[model samples]
Target: MSSQARVSRQIIIQPTGEKPRKDRPMVHYKDRAELKDSVARAARTVWPGNARISVEITGHWSACTGRIFVNNRDAASFAPIVPRTAPETEAFDFGGQAS
Candidate 1:
């Protein structure tokens, strides 16, 4: 996709717990301990038996009118989420930009 475009996205992040509220999909924590606690709580509510979650982050490429789907099942197993490096796309930034 080109650099200039307005995109509409649906980020489905099932974090091994009940689906997050539509208004607030992320759990913010100040520290690692706090994050761990939050995850534990979420696990209790979402999946108690170590069941894994499947994430589906889909959107449209406004520049090209193409569909995008970024998904990861069992995301909890991957402590840090990072796709292996590729030559074409050197960096991945999650921050949304105004178009």
Candidate 2:
């Protein structure tokens, strides 16, 4: 007889304030080291930066799931800021000569 296992994963992204659109593809590993390696590879590809990553694994022998959290540097500071203003009521003269 054959048995099946249930697996799932969740990836959380920080600083960018974004999350994965869907669960990551499940992967089977022979040992804990293999699982760590796989997760590390995925993390590098998903968040390539000087970010902190953490993984949580849970489940019984027949199945396993994980959650990966990545805290990246804030990127909003590089964005340009635009000032909001009301519409001009009158047209101003651009030339040096007074209107």
Candidate 3:
């Protein structure tokens, strides 16, 4: 049976090359434009300087009490690469279904 549940939507930003952690979220954005602006502002402040990072725009799907995410290197870009993704994009399920 499927019921309605709040599907949180936020753009998550993190440094790449590090193990994924389920720890509390530190930075998140609800709007793609805002996210881009934030990143741009940061870039202008303290340059990435060889630091690698990734941005994940997630929401509209359930995780089933497990990890679900996607890393799109092809979607990476200097400016707003906005995967042009929609809330219905493919699910990035990294964990099995919850029993």
Among these predicted structures, which one has the highest TM-score? 2
The residue-by-residue lDDT of candidate 3 on 1-99, one tens digit each, is 333332333323233354333322222233443443444333332234434433333442232111112232322222111224523233442121222
Q: What is the C-alpha local distance difference test score of each model?
A: 0.31, 0.39, 0.31
What lDDT tens digits, residue by residue, belong to model 1 across residues 1-99? 334322222222343445533332233333333333444444344444544433222232221111111232443321222235533232233222421
Candidate 2 structure quality by residue, lDDT tens digits, 53-80: 6555544322233556566333211111
What TM-score would you give candidate 2 relative to the actual structure? 0.39
User: Order the candidates by TM-score, highest first — what do you get?
Assistant: 2, 1, 3
Task: State each model's C-alpha RMSD to the native.
Answer: 13.7, 21.8, 12.5
27 in model 1: Cα distance from truth in Å? 1.6
Q: Which 10 residues in a row give candidate 2 its minimum summed lDDT? A: 74-83
The TM-score between candidate 1 and the true structure equals 0.27
